[model samples]
Target: MNAPARLRVAAGQATSVPRDVAANVATACSLVTTAADQGARVVVLPELFLTGYAAEEWRHDDSLALDASTGSGGPDERLRPLADLARERGVTVVASAAVRRALDASTLSAVVLTPDGEVRAPYDKQHLCGLEEQGFFTAGDHGATIVVDGWELGLGICYDGSFPEHAASAAAAGATAYLTPAAFFTGSDHRRDLYYAARAIDNGIYVVFAGLTGTCGASSFSGGSAVYDPEGRAVARTGADDPAVVVADLDIAEVRRVQDEVNTVARDRRDSLGHRERLEVGRAG
Candidate 1:
């Protein structure tokens, strides 16, 4: 079924408690509640939010990784609250964490909990950065897109958004919006915004960023979570240095207008260099 032209989404920016899944999950639940109260049907949170973004510190801590073992499909007990919240609020929640069956097999993953209380296939971060590459996370092999309210949302992590092809693949896979969970450091807002805006304009898709805020380990996050339209305009954004949520309505009509009249990047894309593979699509139950 096709969703309406407009869908309201929320980006929740907050700090994670170092290695404390309980506290972080509690905060995430609160954010979901707040976003739902504001009528947002989809809510996004920061990268590795289950445990604060301290790759060097928790890199080898097996206890910090959420269980992603593929067997009898059961949601991680620690994250059951989020699934329950999603079901109760009728919202799709995108949140990230380090997940693995073992320490060496860990991946930084974005968990998509839908309104039906199912933990969909998690989108693993495909691009690993400095500390993340140093034995902390294994890069994902393919991209993931999910259906929420009939909108195809492409999933990306912080570093993944830096590459143009990453977002392009999602757009090629029929995604109208790219949802990113980022843990951008303080003072990198310019680069962050540029990357997001460029990706949006390049693919003619909305770019939604949900960032970490406050201090964590040796890094401080100035939350500049935002939503950029297909034309790279800032539709909505949150303030810095604090926990906040920004809600915006994403209209497919704008994307259609841009692709049809303004930017013709999609039509100009070549199959050789441009993305050709359709991303695995998970539909909300």
Candidate 2:
């Protein structure tokens, strides 16, 4: 039999200020290290943690982009040092930023760094929020899912999590875990909490929300980072406390048990998604 499948994950919650790339990177690196030291192999940060969400500088600057149209975000410009951080700390990091496509347009991206310090292919956020059009970021064509170790992981940004379609799509794609990196402000917690549990239980998968914890412009980021198990129960969470790492251990065996017994995904997987005017394979809503 295969060795028992287990993964230790951490959601790193911190504030990212506008126009402060170095500081944001430093904070992420520190949190990544802390998570690694705490035995977490995977560490996730809030959306746009590199340059801060809603930062005008990111919209205007091409060099601030994570990847260029040439298909590669060359090491230095892409914060290749983050790979070094992962390599040194023996952890994989998931974080988001902007990838410049043109002088006036960029893609909101979720970047994955391997333990070997390699920048893995990034997942661009497919859904944009209200008034985000005021910014220069472009909507990605589709969402993405990837396998990490034995776990199939899916990526979602802030607003993307609100729609059941995104998580359902990942689940249909064989994602056993979903991570949403958000910079949600006050009054958004309840909805997020509701869906986080709903999505996990509906799909019989684990979910993690890595949230921010401070103010930006007129908004106040509420730092309620949390993780939920396949049963849709909160396994770990930050008490809206200061910047912190909310860590948890997930088991693939448990996921299998849930599927074999409870098996919700199997019952509704086909009903929600389809091809050609057909509902998406995983989209229930």
If scored against the real structure, what TM-score would every candidate get?
A: 0.90, 0.88
Candidate 1 local distance difference test against the native: 0.85
Q: Estimate every model's Cα lDDT from 0 to 1.
A: 0.85, 0.78
Cα RMSD (angstroms) for every candidate in the order listed: 9.1, 5.8
Per-residue lDDT tens digits for candidate 2, residues 142-256, read: 7787566767889998788888878888888888889988877777788878878887888888998898778754567887888999989999988566679988999998888
Tell me, by TM-score, which candidate is best: 1
Please give the range of 10 consecutive residues that has the lowest summed lDDT in model 1.
63-72
Residue 231 displacement (Å), model 1: 0.2
Show the lowest summed lDDT stretch of 10 residues, model 2.
69-78
For residues 7-119, could you state the per-residue lDDT of candidate 1 as single tens digits?
A: 99999988888778888889999999999999999999999888678765675564343446651145767778888999999999998877664645777888788888987
lDDT of 2: 0.78
Off by over 4 Å in 1: 59-67, 272-285
TM-score of 1: 0.90
Clashing pairs in 2: 273-280, 273-281, 274-279, 274-280
